[model samples]
Target: MSQPQGFDQRDDQSDRALRPKRLADFTGQVPVTRNLSLAIQAARQRKEQLDHVLLSGPPGLGKTTLAHIMAAEMGAEIRETAGPLIEKPGDLAGILSSLKQGAVLFIDEIHSLKRVVEEYLYSAMEDFRITIQLGEGATTQALTLTLPPFTLVGATTREGQLSAPFRSRFGIRERLDLYSPDELGRILARSATLLGVAADAPGLATIARRSRGTARYANNHLRRIRDLAQVSYGNRIDVAVANEGLAMLGVDAAGLTELDRRILGCLATHRRAVGLKTVAVTVGEDEATIEDIYEPFLIQSGYLVKTPTGRLLTVKAYQHLGLTPPEADENQQRLF
Candidate 1:
């Protein structure tokens, strides 16, 4: 199974091994990586710890991977955890206190942090210290613990949910975008070589086109195809083998999953803009999953459009289903 930014732990080992160890090895995300490279270089030139960084983007786009790459580039040990895991102030404090000087503390899904815990980070990020109350009522006393100078790297898909003060503290912030088809192809090629899978360009391209612009999906898709190839294609994955695997998995030529097609099918039936909740109910998916995971690619690939009202299937979506679409006029185009 694919790790989410994979906080689930079961997929950690392979996830880390497949991840790019250096900034140079990381693919796509040119603009973010460029600025980060300069920032890391400048910090290294000064012989100082890099500033706190916040990486915002959809899941599986390599925000956590970039954080790890940064730690490696800085030659620092990285401690990793998710925001919800660090519940109380003491939980946050303990992680901060245990860090060595110049360590990188990576917090994934940082937008999920409780307000109390987030507030505790302000001082730790700024003055490198945290203050905690040490007793009950009459005996209560505030005690401050100084933390080692370190970098805080946080990754989240919901950047808008972050508080203003919390967002302002990060010296470096970057949003990772979806990868292009060619970029995913390159990533899949590298992964195939690493896994000792014999795959041609067409095989990789076939899988890449179905990866929905996410590296995590690309890797996952490649591995599945490799397994299928081993069973029937003499361990060689060609375009035909790739397509057969994808067909079995229910991933279409356009990379739409069963859920994605369900969302589109809902739009087709609605024949008009529909709210996310409606689609979620129709497709048996959570509203957030529809908005975050499935919708972006549908919109990007021109199969769907988000109107002021809701989501509408584009002409391309209907055509993909082998059905004729209603006449789309200039008015509908403007709504897009």
Candidate 2:
């Protein structure tokens, strides 16, 4: 399914096991998890349907996992789909009508829905019904199908793209924040245990720091490192084993990937803040991807900064690249 740039793609039967099973098992977003738990309890006590939920955040922060957790916590069934898959009004209507009472209809990348389809969603969420017009000309008739009271759980990386009416229809909204390195280490440890891989704390911490504040990245690195350890060193992963394996993949000490290096190298050529388009042209990636996938981490890590004029490579970025930074203009010296 089409999603916002960089949404998690490894979601299958095998990969789904990597996700935390319940709200308690979820490792980060403490506030969000707590609030969701209370909301679920309140709804259950009242014997009412849980409010429609909106999970908005950058990709790979476990938004989909939370959607599933919501259904599990409420003891309600969940139907998973993406915005792009529901291309027509009938598609939305069919799914809505088929849902059992209090079921969760989870739609990932809700912002990608066509404007017309999105408009169709408003009534379904608000009134638990879909009004469809059948036939054309004089034979046309308006048919309103009453659906079971169901919760709509929408996940989006681009919250701004949703129309105001569509956005307001969701009764509960929560944003998932990036995980800290410490939280990521704990998650990595859990993943290693589940995968039956022998990983030490130091090794996990090393990978966590380089995980770009993402659990998916950390898990991928852990599997790769574990494979390397098994083949070359008897499956025991320590600090040395993790470092040596990751270094071979061009993941530097700061966890910057090859593309990150390329971006810094391209930006360094200008020696000044440069527009995103110029960076994309030089880096050979589209502007949308750079904005959605790359820039967030770069800015969060203090390796890059965005300003009104453009993006500037920070001193830390140059230092990580092992290059001397050029003299900065007095106006651009301070970090934003």
Candidate 3:
């Protein structure tokens, strides 16, 4: 059977096992975890539902994991849904009305919610109530339903897409940042223990350095490398084994993937600032994926820069690709 457009069977199965069940077990995003711990403690003390939370960051940086953690920490049952799935006000109402008291309603990609559906959420989030129309035209009647005092945990990769009015509804908002290699290494070490894989520090460090500063990427890379180690390396991973696995997966020492290089190559070909649409078309990726997934690491790694006009490759990118930067870019590089 074919999966849905954005669903990944591998993630569906593996993520649950690898995910940190409690906030205390989570590895990265220190600031976010810290704030959430305090909030959870306060809410528990008050014997009230936790405040609605908004978590925004690049995909695979553990927004979904954190949502589940929040639910676990609060000892609340969680109901999960995505923004695109709730297409209408009725759909939102149905999900909202079903929640038990002190439950957590996790909505992934919350910024993709429709304008009308988002508005319908205002009262539900604020007052734990919703008003719905019972009929059409002259027969229409407004019925307000009281919902359980559940905490709404919304996650988004693009927070700017949400309207100011919608954004303001959340009582708590936290933006997760990319993980440092050390943080990712710590996460990978824990994962190795859980997976029962024998891995050395250098081997895990090698994988962590190339994990694109995301714990999800680090864990995924560890799993793939573990397969290689099991079959070819006596169920043990060393630095050489990790390097071989990453090379087999087409990830470079710098952690850039084939698609990452293609995006860089596209920018290199243009030799000037290029618009996102042009890069997306050339790289065979959607604009959002490039912007949200690929571009962040590129910018963070000093391989690319975004100006008001467009994106421009840096001298580091040209060197990585074994190409020469234009003279103007060469002079600009000297300035830095």
Best by lDDT: 3
lDDT of 3 by residue, 75-95 (tens): 999999999999999999888
Clashing pairs in 2: none
* Per-residue lDDT of model 2, residues 1-336, tens digit only: 233221236544545788898888889899999989999999999999899999998777899999999999999999999988988988988888889999999999899999889988888888877898899999999999888899999999889888888888888999987889999999999988988888899999999998888777787788778889989988889999999978876788888888778888987888788899999899888887778667788889888988888888888888887887776764455643
- Name the candidate, 2 or 3, with the larger lDDT value: 3
TM-score of every prediction relative to native: 0.94, 0.94, 0.95
Native RMSD of candidate 3 (Å): 2.6
Backbone collision count in every prediction?
0, 0, 0
The lDDT of each candidate is 0.86, 0.85, 0.88
Question: What does the lDDT read for residue 7 in candidate 2?
Answer: 28
Off by over 4 Å in 1: 1-12, 329-336
Query: How much is 174 displaced in model 3, in angstroms?
Result: 0.6
Q: Candidate 1 residues 91-166, lDDT tens each? A: 9888888999999999998999999999989999999989978889999999998888999999998899999999
User: Residue 235 error for model 3, in Å?
Assistant: 0.6
RMSD of 1: 2.6
Candidate 3 has which clashing residue pairs, if any? none
